[model samples]
Target chain A: MYDEPYRWIEAVANRRQYLDDQFIHGSPLVGISCAQGVLLLTFNRGTEKIYEIYDRIALGGMGHPADLEKLRFTLLDMAHVEGFQRSPSDVTASRLLKNGLAPVIKPAFEEIMRAPYIVKILLVELGTSQDRDHLFTMDYDGMFAEQREFGVLSASSSSGDRLSAEWKSFGVVASLSSALEIGLRLWGVASLLQDSSTSPEVKIEEKDKPSSTSPSETPEEAEVTTRIREMLANETLECVLLDRESGKMETYRSLGQSDLQPLIPTEFQPAT
Target chain B: MGQQGDFLQVLGEQGYDVERVFSSHKVDALHASGMVTTGTTVLAMKYRDGVLVAGDRRATAGNVVMYDRTDKVLELDRYSILAIAGVPATAFEMARILEHSFKYYRRSQLQDLSFEGKLRALSTLLKNNAPAALSGTGTVVPIFAGYDLHDTCGKIFFYDILGAEFEAVEYAVSGSGSSTIRGIMFYLNRWSQRTMVELDEEEALTLVLRLMTSAAEFDSATGGIDTQAQLYPIVKGISAEGVRSIPVERLSQLFSEKVVNHV
Candidate 1:
């Protein structure tokens, strides 16, 4: 008798706590850099987490059900339905976000706003337009934050800060590898910080991390430095980008762990 | 709380026990007797760029012909195509639900369903109709094919009456003439020395017409392109571009020049 997505509403409400608990378990990450006619997203295959890859909208999810793959598809279908029934020209990013996306995600949001799932979407446009690409980071409550240039949503803030700085230095129209350079370094830093913080031997307070006066190669830092080199030396990267001339999105995989070695700066790698 | 308080009271008034509707029932072959009108001969295959799906135009009730111009093929979503071959009414309803669900899902998630995901959803719907299938009334099975953005190629899946799914490597067919159609495709693929992926969209369309015609020869229920009725089989293709039905004029030409004159 109930048809307005009420079928799942009751169940979603009952399992609200379970979903929230799962969201706190794993930390998935994505690095995005967009320029005047080009947008690029880099995913970390090293984590083996599920990611929601949909048409026109590829998002990185950090929460329960690792890959919110169905949600991504439903979102695309909603956009298509809005664009269709009316006219094909009606299919635009701005229109989809306003009329298609916002209204659709509202019901699920209201059901369990306290859930810990966080969604970061890189909205790529296939049509030729002068408008810029959009990066939207949404929390469980449907709060939307728009980012320009670059954005990183992860468990660690230090990594975000470092990535932001890299974005600034790379400038607009930076190649995909340049953006990946920033992501790889930040990924190493974040993982090491997490490992060190969780170690029983390290009892330092959060404020004194990477202590300014602690000098460069401490034993803990040395261990982190070694792990980064190993990961970089054997990492296989998966990258997707939106084509400018054809306006088509293409996904490609670059093999070899050392493939990215050239892009990683000397300072980030361990001394040979 | 909204409808919970009224459930027991309502059931009491209606003279029905709570277990009647909610709990499992032990019933045997007691619903509708046999299927009414049924559709036949739905075929789908993966080509180089995208998927090619086609279906016949006839609806049959045992020995009697119920309707012509019945479209058996349906577009499930922007990126997928469905060809139904079961109870005509249930098939139509299933198509409608599928179209709605895929659209609802994409909008809610802001993405297109994966090729495998679409197949799984269709299979779930079929499984849900188990009661109807058992009683022999609402049974529906269809061949699903579509372009997967992830794989960047065409993919096809078929389902049984029980709603179990089977993935087809090269081609798939359902209804009264599946074996006949399957053999024709196999022969052509072997003789022509072209892998399914090597065939262009146009060549794929022609092959589908030829196969449907051969299938119509054996299965009276299967409809071929009828020149007198000016009716053609429903044909559609899916590519990286999207799902689109092949125009009637082109189909008529192909039937006349390729299938009719040659065969």
Candidate 2:
């Protein structure tokens, strides 16, 4: 069904590298701020999508996956120390995600300084009531914006077109399964799959050549998308939830392929 | 003074005493009114799980006991504690500067400074104050102790007025009463050699308390524990669990049972 050679992704990968041209770069991160906690879900592109959470915070980030990994550990260390000195309540989601970004980013922006890479960080607070929880998107430039309901940040498209468009349809009362479903779909191999409802007449070949209306979807997009879905399907979907009952960050999760299989669309076919 | 003069250029424009303040080891108006005074005992020892650091609460002006509630022991991080025995202002300022610097490091690096790194930094601070140390008017000699995660044991570091750093195995003590307390610790170290690993928190705390009490017994400058003022030597432990102080209630108990009752 696919003309180009598909790059296979490993179920357990530590790093990811991206191609320069029009690519459905890495997977986009989708976050939904809930009434009790916030859910941040992203597809595993080539590198391992870093999902880190402790007591009252969960963070997921994209960009130079290596730099993202560094940023992740730094944030966790800062939050842990802050939680230790002050009450755990002092570690707010936005403060950790926003205020904490500068020190890591500024050093790279030294004398002849330029931001090293683009990194989008999503954070959610689990200790507060879901409404009080904060959802934030921070860029490498160290600018962050709070999102009330839902937000999706894509790396492939310059403006993250697909992600921004999909949030309107992502309901506020959407269940956890649907949040992950929408995320897997947007970053899924089927991203190039023509919406089954629209143009059932358009062949899979036309889907390869994305319409001009959509920002440059990766030209070799189908194979990329297919590999992303297959790689994601075999691995467990990582998640961090604040168990409303326990009032604690839920770190241990076993989200097997069986659990998320429903999110995989039938029309989606791996480009083997 | 030339408006465009560089620092050295400006010093030349002024007199030579200006240069003396800049490069020479001479304490002058740069120091506070009461900077180089000393007279207290602070000692630390390695135990089973961590190192115990402590300092007597007395502040002295020569032979006069000026204050009885000073806290000479400062916690640098979760894993390190510093006890100072020097000029009151200089000691407190050094501790304050260190604390602020560590907070900056923690906030920026997103991690605590390493034990060795902390020692180097303190050395740098003391090195900056070499003139005061040489003048003997604003000197600071400190004993730093902390848990070394890499070595899996408690360790101690000592500093001189010139900011020379030395790592001590087993135990270290500093201050006017150091000569007396060192003798006590050396004797205790020989007795405890039979089962060094068996030394626990209680034993470490009691040892530090005994050192401080005995130091004050003969030294008029180092005051003993004052229950009337609710002042006792400040004792802290640094381990994998991080730096924490022994509770005052427990300190009071140790003071009454070990020092007060024995006396």
Candidate 3:
């Protein structure tokens, strides 16, 4: 039906709106670089949203799981084939996005005849040190932006901004434990911000806001922490670390609940 | 043509014709002229804890030593290693293919390729190189050793030039220098008081060093150890924890005290 150029443009706009509606409930993903390495965190019911795409590269998505999986494998196929044809060190986040994912995703998204991919992707590459780390974020429309220390993906731009603002206020984190603390707190803020955007009429349940433990947490952030703790009752946090000090060729490590127990605060721990 | 996890098929789809690439007439001419460099003497044996894999650092073409300090034992992944015994060019390409294959499988499938699957992947690559192997242009008789998570122990598998795979229960050896010590390894494993399985890491390492030394003594292609240059064989241990390279310093100390002094 989108034979005319104007019709095609309108259809594409409609597709964007549809995709936004679909992702209104999408959980936000957080990625940040620390002294130890880089980490990607998200809370989910069970499925994993974080993945290792190569030796130093990782991927986290905040959209349709099936679409994310397909994109993940496509990226994997491209990465591994590129590494095989060229070199492992050549498979950087920028190259993968520029020459690999963007090319494929952009065409699919623009083709009015074909269904578009409704996923937001965050890819990170751990460098030799924290300063050199590369974090990139890709929107549903194939537009991508590169950041040095932090990247986030969510359904709403407001929530994404909230995550970025929270990260900036936290400053540089030297240890992974401290990064995890800040990441989870930002995740909490993003989730609440997304919920508020989706349903402005409804307010977050006013449960007993847990005593703010961190000195940096604002009153609003503390309220978000309590709201997230309630979410932890049914949902679990998934965190993947690309550690620089792992001393192995492969640096991607998934932090399990037991491993995160000590790093996670008491108020945030999911109920057993 | 193969499954989604088939790396060779993936490469094939990308215009990488393994058979053609390996069986090029130019490479055939080089092989006939005896200019194709070949690595020598790689061995793997089961010890009490895991498996010890060792390979001498020598690449030779005809009568000339092309190079030393060649790493024949290549770590393909966290748990697996490939020790090659023939044309380094073809073997190195195969090594790179297998390395990417494992990672590709893991990433696409979301699980590590099973040990048996890994064994077959190599077989498929070797089979694809049949023309090169048959023409004596790119023959690679390699020993594949890894910590099999399902088996909960280190395992060794050897392959012929034609891709036929055989499991070595006690030990496996390949390359030109292997002939010098294969029978001795068989004898020691069979008749010695401490079988290959019973030997500890140090003992296993000492045995491998002695085997390489003996192979070097009789085989000029094997650059077993260079005392002046402090060059030692590359030794890797595969256990449940993963692959760990035995450092050069440890290899040197063992070579002097155990292999050289016969302590």
Candidate 4:
């Protein structure tokens, strides 16, 4: 039996590349978006392997690939072993957050530093179970979070640091939508910085803009227009925000097309 | 005597008549009802994620509606639902009794009974009523549905008058309006592959109501949605969150939107 088991392990290792190839070719990204923000998560249950693409909510590294499977096991344990009669929804985010389990998976900030891609994470403790609780986020690495509101993760280390400093300047926004707007603004700025460093055209677009004020617009409108133009120039790097109030997660290609359009000047139209 | 025996005795004392109706006999009975005092339609279909149970609000006593506010559909638990047809009064009475018993059991035990347990209990109640129903009084038939968490998908069960149950793999329909509803469902089957998240609860309820409305329009025994009275067909969902009734306002909005689009 032992010899057979060893051979089985070797066979699996040898065929691992083929399995991975099959998964990579078969799986596709599934995303959800609405008025608030957008979330993109990948599913590859067929092979029992999982990976995290982008996460800013800080609930530990996108959790293990087997986390969901383990959660299902926990649910079965609760129902069968522990005799806890409760709906699966009752065992989720808001409940975990209320029980203060959000911080259990501490921010492994060092792991994030080694990653090639920038990371951002938001975590809300939903509730606790006798055995486990839940941590929900808008984006976890590449895993999609579908709850109405509670937490968000924004990308860009330098921009994130700057936004954290400026966050204190803005008054407390208790609503999820407001928090998402702030996060989107921070993400937009970070994306711009990232694009300017990698692309020559964005740098030229910034340099060509006139430093002097336009003659007709008010100061606020002019500022809004400039910001919109800057965002539009880096439209490929979109900013997503989650509005918990409406249960909508929306993605904005440029600030001009965002809900803040009323603040932008009429002359500054987003390029479709 | 035990409570079960007492229950059976009471059922026998009541002048209820129940008899097994095969598929051929059911069709004959449908013809005999003069198409007026027809059975209401009850339908349950299993989708990829969960079960969809539906029923029209119309109950006829000869040619007229016995009640407009009738809800012939019920969610028995988070993962289980039931739809009733046959004699309106008898079916409603049976439903209320079963609901009360389930609630009492839950409250007493401080835990929910399993889906199979619930079904077994219902079967017992129907079997006990066999003596009275064998006479000529009335009978109740129901279609039960649930999401078996262990199974990780939806399941549906249909019952005969004698309480003999059969599990339907895809779809099951019963009652006076069943043929029409089934006709509409057969056409909609092509799109049933879509995930539950892709279709909001509001949209799902509208689809059910549309099928019901279409059935009512063609079948004299089935009633169309009463917009003037603000009464709509009953729709419920059983998922990981438990059983929840769809809001009437949402149903009304969808109905209006569909009507506008059609016109």
lDDT of 1 by residue, A24-97 (tens): 32443554543423333333445523232333444455544432444454444544444333444455555555
For model 3, what is the alpha-carbon lDDT of residue A168?
78
Pick by DockQ: which candidate is best?
Answer: 3
| Residues B1-263 of candidate 4: C-alpha lDDT, one tens digit per residue | 11231222232333223233211122435434544243587777654445678777777766766666667787654466779887665565566555544543443233456678778877976776665455424566789887776666677899988899999877788887888877667666656676333465556666677778878877877767888898777877666655567678878888889753656
Higher-scoring candidate on DockQ, 3 or 4: 3
Report clash pairs, candidate 3.
none
Q: Across residues B190-221, which tens digit of lDDT does each residue of candidate 3 receive?
A: 89987889998888888889999999999988
Chain B of model 2: TM-score? 0.82
In order of appearance, the predictions have TM-scores of: 0.47, 0.57, 0.93, 0.42
Q: Which runs in model 1 stand beyond 4 Å of their true positions? A: A1-272, B1-35
lDDT by residue for model 1 (B1-263), tens:
10121222332443534233222234333223323777599998878767788899889876678788898888877788889887776777667656655654543443555677677767866776766666566667888888888888778888888888888998899988777878878877778777876888777778888888889889988877788878888989888888888998898888788877875
1 versus 3: better TM-score goes to: 3
C-alpha lDDT score of every prediction, in listed order: 0.60, 0.62, 0.86, 0.48
lDDT tens digits, residue span A1-272, model 3 = 78888998999999888888888887899998999999999988777899989999999998888889888877887887788899888889999888878987888889988888889999999999888899999988899999767787877675555566787788768788889888888777877667665664432322233453322322386687787688666677889999999998789999998888798777676556
Query: What order do you get sorting by lDDT, best first?
Result: 3, 2, 1, 4
Q: List ranges where model 2 is wrong by over 4 Å.
A: A1-24, A27-60, A65-117, A122-135, A139-144, A148-272, B1-39, B60-69, B88-115, B191-198, B220-223
Q: What share of the true interface contacts does each candidate keep?
A: 0.14, 0.00, 0.59, 0.00
DockQ value for model 3: 0.56
Q: Residue A6 in model 2: shift from native, Å?
A: 39
**Model 2 lDDT on a 0 to 1 scale:** 0.62
Number of the predicted model whose TM-score against the real structure is largest: 3
